[model samples]
Target: MKICLVGSSGGHLTHLHLLEPFWGNKERFWVTFDKEDAKNILANERKYNCYFPTNRNVKNLIKNTYLAFKILKSEKPDIIISSGAAVAVPFFFVGKLLKIKTVYIEVFDRIDKPTLTGKLVYAVTDLFIVQWEEMRKVYPKAINLGGIF
Candidate 1:
């Protein structure tokens, strides 16, 4: 299946990279907001740049929506898997609207409480996963899939 990986930079990117063993030469694309992470990932494969605004203002939300629109039209991915902050929010929302299967994996560090992205995306995601089973107490629908990376 054609899969799009979405996340913010740093730990999120690192987390997704762990799934490399499941990849072949070219079945996936990445969507992220970090310049350094983009540079590193693009050294081998192409990726989509989701906007990372300096201000968390309305303008930034608009930009993210536009970016999501373009990506949905261009990529037409069958599935979207995300380790999110905020940029992945629009993509996941658009993915659901487009009838694509959406999967959101909660961050490893967030065992005590759900992250904002996790809580918001839970309603739309086709699959919601948590590394720790403890998270299931809060979100019973979530799959305790262990860790992806």
Candidate 2:
């Protein structure tokens, strides 16, 4: 199966990195934020196009939407796995619209509440996972997968 790992830089990327072992035996793709620090990390690798302004910047949303479609159209991945933040929102939606399975790993830092993007993408996601088991009570659909990375 072709799994598309999407997330922001920092911790999101780290989480995805941990799950990299799972994809070593399967065809996989990655999509992390294109920040100055992350630019070279995912480069020269099999990762898809990266985005900028990793935060909830206004200007980047529209651009991200277009890029999302481009990635979805080109990659046509079978599934998407993401660690929450705003950037993953567009990518997750792309997978949803394309009828692709998606695994969402809630941010490790969000212990008591849901992140904005996490809440937004929950309904459409195929498998919602969390590091903390307590989150399962709030997000009844989520599975407790412990930590990714």
Best by lDDT: 1
* Pairs that collide, model 2: none
lDDT of 1 at 107: 90
CA-lDDT, candidates in order: 0.81, 0.79
Least accurate 10 contiguous residues by lDDT in model 1:
52-61
Per-prediction tally of clashes: 0, 0
How do the residues 1-149 of candidate 2 rate in per-residue lDDT, one tens digit apiece?
88787877877787777775787688777777656545666665576555677566767877887888998889888888888678788887877887888888888887768989889899999999988988987799998888655
Name every residue pair that clashes in candidate 1: none
| lDDT of residue 45 for candidate 2 | 55
User: Residue-wise lDDT of candidate 1 within 1-149, one digit each (tens)?
Assistant: 88888877778787777777755554888878758866786568768777776235567668887888788879898888888878778888888888999988899888869988888799999999899989999789999988665
Residue 6 accuracy (lDDT) in model 2:
83
